[model samples]
Target: MNINLTLIGQSITFLAFVWFCWRFVWPPLLGVMQEREQKIASGLEEAERASKDLELARRKAAEQLKEAKEQAAEIIDGANKRANQIIEEAKNAAEAEGDRLKAAAKAEIEQEVNRAKEQLRSRVATLAVAGAEKILSVNIDAQAHDDLIEKLAAEL
Candidate 1:
């Protein structure tokens, strides 16, 4: 065998193999690689979008939470104010009731005192008529002497 012929044959075989791969095999392989690269790029873009959406959702949730807290604080403050108003109203009502009771008690006391004074005046007039009758040695008719007793009670 000649060395140059062997070298030439191997060179031609290598060229033929490279040409075959380029024409029949490389196209499908390149296409598959391009499809894989597009899928990867789309997946990366979708991941980035999902991450942004998650961030937006988190921010929105935080804002809502803050608003809820503010609303709750307002509600609590309103409740406190209402409670204070209710308490003040109750206190005012109680005070008014106390004043009314005191006035009623004062009126009742005055009525009782006036009743006692009338009774005492009647008793004193009766006693004075009895003493006058005893001193004059005459029995007094109360119904006939009613006007004198009235005058005497008035004087006392």
Candidate 2:
């Protein structure tokens, strides 16, 4: 091809090309690329922060689990001690009550036996006097009957 080289035409073409690139291509394209790069950088930073937060949460959970285990052990120990104390106190109280009941029953039985013996003695004395009177066909004197009752009571 034959060369067509002119300074003015070359300068005009270069100016038009530069104008087109500045107006239609360079501004929006460079702006979009820069915005995309900034967004990627922000996303990477957010991911790193989230990872740190997760580690912190895991550590806090481990501490809470340990504290909970200690509290549970203390509660169980306290319950066991309280149960033992209650059992001991109950046993002592039951023994005391049994002893008191046993003593009361023994006293009542002794009193009842004494009362029965007294009643039987009185009845036997009355029957013996009645038989003696029937056999003799005579009424006994009051003073003699009283003396006989006294003797029988003393012997019993």
Candidate 3:
């Protein structure tokens, strides 16, 4: 065989192989690479969106926590005020009860004093009648002198 003819045949075969690869195999490979690149870009965008959503959730949770703390403070303040009001009411009720008891005791003491005074007046009238009968040397008829005895007892 001629060396030049063999070299030319080899060169033509190499060219045909290169063209086939470019038309068929290379197109599919390039398509796969572009599809992978697009998928990676979309995944990066989704990750960025998820990060923003997480930040927003954190802010909302912080706001809710602040509102809850404020509501708790308000509830505590209201409870304290109500406790103070109840204490004042109890104190007033106790004072009123004490005053009523004192008044009742004073009235009872006055009634006892009046009863003693009445008993003493009756005893004094009886003693005077006995003395007058002994001095006059006669038994005094108390029933007959009922009006006089009653008048003298009233004066005593």
Candidate 1 lDDT over residue span 50-146, tens digit each: 9999999999999999999999999999999999999999999999999999999999999999998889877886787676687457756767677
Which stretches in model 2 have alpha-carbon errors above 4 Å?
1-5, 120-155
What is the per-residue lDDT of model 3 for residues 1-156, given as tens digits with 9 covering 90 to 100?
557888989999999999999999999999999999999999999999999999999999999999999999999999999999999999999999999999999999899888888887778767866766774576557675666667676777
Global fold similarity of model 3 (TM-score): 0.69
State which candidate has the highest lDDT: 1
Give the backbone clash total of model 1.
0
lDDT of 2 by residue, 78-128 (tens): 999999999999999999999999999999999999888888877877777
Query: Which runs in model 1 stand beyond 4 Å of their true positions?
Result: 1-24, 138-156
**What total of clashing residue pairs does each candidate reach?**
0, 0, 0
What TM-score does model 1 achieve against the real structure? 0.73
The candidate 2 region of ten consecutive residues with least summed lDDT is 127-136
Name the lDDT value of residue 132 in candidate 2. 60
Q: Which candidate achieves the best TM-score against the true structure?
A: 1
What TM-score goes with each of the models? 0.73, 0.70, 0.69
Candidates ranked, most accurate by TM-score first: 1, 2, 3
Error of 1 at 139 (Å): 13
